[model samples]
Target: MPNPPRLRATALTATAVLLCPLLAGCGGDDPKDPDLTAQKLSWKDCPAPSAPEGGGAAPSPLPNGGRWQCATMKAPRDWSDPKAGTIDVALIRVRASGGKSQRIGSLIFNFGGPGGSGVTGLPAFADDFAELRTRYDLVSFDPRGVGRSAAVECKNAKQLDTYLQVDMTPDDAAEERKLLDGTESFNAACEKNSGAMLPHVRTTDAARDMDLMRQVLGDRKLYYFGISYGTELGGVYAHLFPKNVGRAVFDAVVDPTQNPEQGSLGQAKGFQLALDNYARNCVSMAEGCPVGDTPQDVKNRIAVLLKNLDAKPIPGIPPRKLTQSLATDGILQALYSQELWKYLTQGLYQAYQGDGKVLMLLADSLNGRNENGEYSNLIPANVAISCADDKPRYTVKDVTAKLPEFRAASPLFGDTLAWEMLSCSDWAVPGAAYHPNVSAPGAAPILVIGNTGDPATPYEGASRMVKALGKGVGIELTYKGQGHGAYISGNKCVRNAVDAYLLQGKTPAPGTVCS
Candidate 1:
């Protein structure tokens, strides 16, 4: 399951028939680069990412009959001004093994993260979509300012250490100031280092980029598989190009209707439910459990642990100490999947024993920190794109005002999720108006999948998405399971349904449930 990216403020494609009408602006006369049109990609051998020391090379995620090769495409920095400037788009494709006889065109993917790197993530998808790849080119790209694409630069790894451990639950004026200061400092670094790309990275622009990808890739129609934030992109694309949306699948759906604060409230409750599920399992274990006999008791114990950390952080893993903020992130990360709950339990157990290394490691994994103490640009890119797409949020004072309301919504995680979003207030650019309404009236039926116990994008949002896209073209499938993403979960029925939709534009009747 993809980790839910920490929230903030603000923040693909094609070919053949000039498939995107809206991407070129109204009447399709926004701008032009005749030279950029009709260019075919020159695919080359895939570049290998660095592997861990003594661990040898990481196995390629490419499935049988597929060989990975990559290409670069030039996209307009501002679609409205094709001549103003351009950005290099990094793309990876695994050509269909069925050859020309059975080819169905390219199937693009966006694995959430408003910041997840497509090139680095392609292999796992390649393996998962192996069956579909037999008849389609499996394609994905890091959106502008992300991953292999020109990344959004911000704080250095060492410089970012202290920020992660700040007290996010800030119990007093001084603690709140520290939290605000840390986010403000991080924002300043991003603006100073990545100002140029920030404005151009909005979701609307990214949607336009998808159309450019389609035109260049030679696909007359857009076919995609988007999870989490990818759903946000795909949903926007559908609104813009309803007629061009061929077959799109969005799982672990993130609702666009909710404002920033509402989004946080919903997610906090989602994680709280997931944590309760983890707690239930933990309490039932044969040996001693870290907390108490029930979920509330577990939460009480967690409160004590976080309170203690705020008073005195454990000196952990040389050069980095365990702070309450990092510990909260660590716990949040584990809440994504039950498979990782074991690690959360272990981390909590170790923490209670006066060591914070395990949870710190989990936070590092969620933040994309490497074993070498170096960090990926995931956090920076996530913030950049999110701030560009979302509505502006409250400051420390404003957020504090909403604490009572949020706390009532999620007693365990309300504060952190709400305050973490304050980072958006320091964004370098303004956001597009929040999309409270999303409907693709003329688009093909879009399948919206949700995991009942998902920690990040909760089940209710899936129902909301279905209602918003309710013009007889939205299909909702439910997974009664525990995890962040259902498609990748261990449910055969869910997998088959997803595969069927992607392969044949077929969706089971709405309200289909799989356990």
Candidate 2:
């Protein structure tokens, strides 16, 4: 579920532990220093962006749906070494939908992936984000290694399939060997296929690309909305070019300093926490709830069921086979959205009855498996980006040493999740592994938002980011509900507050708590 990684603060000590050396990189120079001049530009005075030379005047309306047009911008591949190679960024703009008089310049949005596609995000959110669209043109583009732009692609699907097939929770040496060997093969393939682009896909490089997009749009500043992993990109942007940031919102922010090794392990714990939440409030209910009284009971039952599936997987299902592994695979897929919680309930009901068919369907969904035996491009893209962006601070021995803690933190999925990082163990590029202090000297303090009950991005992540930014205030918006990405999801208070901030340059009062 960690498509990309985002912001927030908390009341509890939240236990910010450097518990592992892998998680130890967050310790560095404090980066909070605001730029007063940029902060002073009220929403009214913000400059409007002009169309690029090739694109037509007046953002055009599209036949299919949301307005779309192509635009291009130039940026330094490495900002510090300004004379470094130049990269061309391709952009797609969706003009706002409200009264023309109320039009604002641009509101750039990112779909969370250290390498996610932002090209179609605006259109996807067109209806839900009507308010945001009215005043500002929703702008997004392919970050380096993303859509319609020069993307980083892996040509070896077979090797990747082997890695994906590896047992997430290896029970013995034989399985472990398979995991290690598959990992190495995938790594070799990436290195062999992706050369220079692999290293450059890091979150920092993507942020620099955004700054160039701003200049191309001809806006003196940027109005942004970043979710999940997009939050980290936005944070790095705020840290590097604060002067160019206008009213920015980072919802579900990841602490950039926390690299993938620690972050994924921590995420394993977060997922278990979410499972606990679902078991408590969702399971015992009359309609769709899956479990018998206790959360532990449900978990124990699931374990037994998975063991059975592993030993004797259901028979042939065409090109893609369904085994005990795929049944458990379905469970992980159901965790992505609360909307699918009912599906989980139903799958569990069937699973308890020893019917693995339904669960296989669910797993197929999660694994990006389609009905025609085809798989989604998401996983391939995910592996490439995640492996590239995160530094494996832990070695195989390092991971083994922490098994006890991982298990304690996440019994059902921790070991599997922890082992997931092995994908990068054999990666071709030893990523720069540099975590910079992102607080720019003169950037406006961007609003970092977090939801209390988000399953994918734990509330603690937001708290860590808000605290790290030092000066920026953390706005805790209690959805008191479920699902990920809550900003445009209809919590009136949250929406109104966000709208006011982007449209009027208003920051919710310090320590603002919205429910």
Candidate 3:
């Protein structure tokens, strides 16, 4: 299972394509490189995504006939030492539909994997933001150590296939050793493959890159949209460059206050809440719930299925069996969006019948594996950036000690997540801090949207972010809905409020609630 911090919007989209039809300088003075900043980006037609980017054909044109263009911006490899060598940061954008005078400059987006390729993300969901594109250029990029921006490669496809199958929730000493050995091996692979880029992949370094990107795009202030982990990045950017903040919105807000352990624990509760909601929805449906007669019954059946898989794995995709770990990952993926709920039901129905293809497919999506059996740098970069940003490293004892608390948090997810605390173990680079500092005291009012039922980031994170962003700097908008994000949930109120803020510069009333 992926660490709970990962947001699956882009990955989930990748899954749909397979099933469907074919498809910084450390703070201080702010590094300055006149030549690099003044250099012009040579925007051209985008080519098919590379293997590291989760390979696919180049993005198609927009509905308005505006072509999606790609480019690369140069930035220092290490922000702390601007004099160091440079690296390419891949970018993608489409011009605004509105007249030149009406254009409000570029509106950059970060779809929050810390590892997700904004280059692919912007185009995948371009239609949803077409309105924002009317007045602003829709722009996004592959941050360093992600996608084509000097991607961090680790275990190859074949190796990852085996690594991902290891029992993450080990029950005995031998099983625990296997889990630890696998983790160390994976971490070692990352060091062997991408050691040069490891230390510089921290959030602080990425934040610096964004400021340079702002200057290169000729935008006086950044007009931005961030989701999930992107929210954390945006907050860090705001803190580092409060004066440069423009109209920014953070949806599916991450709590800037929690350390990795607290964040993981919160996800345990959050996902459990979402599961409860999913069960209730299942039983209340007009067609009637097929999985179980009652909410608790549905959960009970799932528990039994998982326990059974742990003991005797079920046949999944050819050559691989659906183990308890993969099944849990598949379930987590389906729970990201309400639209995926039907697929979850279908997967569960098939699993009960001893066919694990659907569930395996879902797990494959989460792990960045496509139908072709190729892997993307998503998981690798996720671990790299997360380890670089998080300070704590766990031991087998640390995880075992916390198992009870984690299981108490969510019998379904606690163990898996607790075990994940060891993801940074034996990492190549030391982490920056316990938690990110998102205190942007003087930044412009950032519209923070939180979904009441968000599983990954949780709703309380909205208020926490608002507080962290400081007085008058953060605006909270509550969306009483489901899913990992609010705006993408297709809620009209959210769209209108966000559109009003980003397009017209009209900040929604603080503490605004949209149901």
Per lDDT, the best of the predicted structures is 3
Each model's TM-score, in the order given?
Answer: 0.91, 0.80, 0.97
Best candidate, TM-score-wise? Answer: 3
Cα RMSD for candidates in order? 5.8, 8.8, 2.9
| Per-residue lDDT of candidate 1, residues 1-515 (tens digit) | 01123531111110000011111123222225766766677888766542210011332535354678888888888766778878888888888888898888998988777776666665654555677787789898888888656678888877767567667777888877777777778888889998988888877777777877887888888898888878878887777777778888888888767777778888878888888898888888988576677777888898898878878988667767787777887787777777777888888888888899888877776676655776667788888787777766567778878888778777777877777668776677876665534677777899999889987888888888877775777799999999777876658898899878877767888999999
Residue ranges of candidate 3 with Cα displaced over 4 Å: 2-30
Task: Put the candidates in lDDT order, highest first.
Answer: 3, 1, 2
Error of 2 at 23 (Å): 14
lDDT of 3 by residue, 1-515 (tens): 42423542344344334443200213424447897889899999999988888888888887669999999999999876778799999999999999899899999999877688888778877878988988999999998999999999989999888888888789899998888888888889999999999998988888888989999999989899998888988998998888899999999988888888888888888888889999999999999998999999999999999999999889999998999989988988888778878888989989999999999988888777887899888888988898888888888999899899999999998988888888887999988788888887778899999999988888999899999889999999999999888887889999999999999999989889999
Score residue 495 of candidate 1 by CA lDDT.
83
lDDT of 3: 0.85
- When sorted by TM-score, best at the front, the candidate numbers are 3, 1, 2
Residue 316 of model 1 has an lDDT of 64
> What is candidate 2's TM-score against the reference?
0.80
Angstrom error at residue 466, model 1: 2.2
TM-score of 1: 0.91
Mind sharing the TM-score for model 3? Answer: 0.97
- Which stretches of model 2 miss by more than 4 angstroms? 1-66, 71-88, 155-162, 288-293, 315-317, 323-329, 351-377, 434-436, 472-479
In order, what lDDT does every prediction score?
A: 0.73, 0.58, 0.85
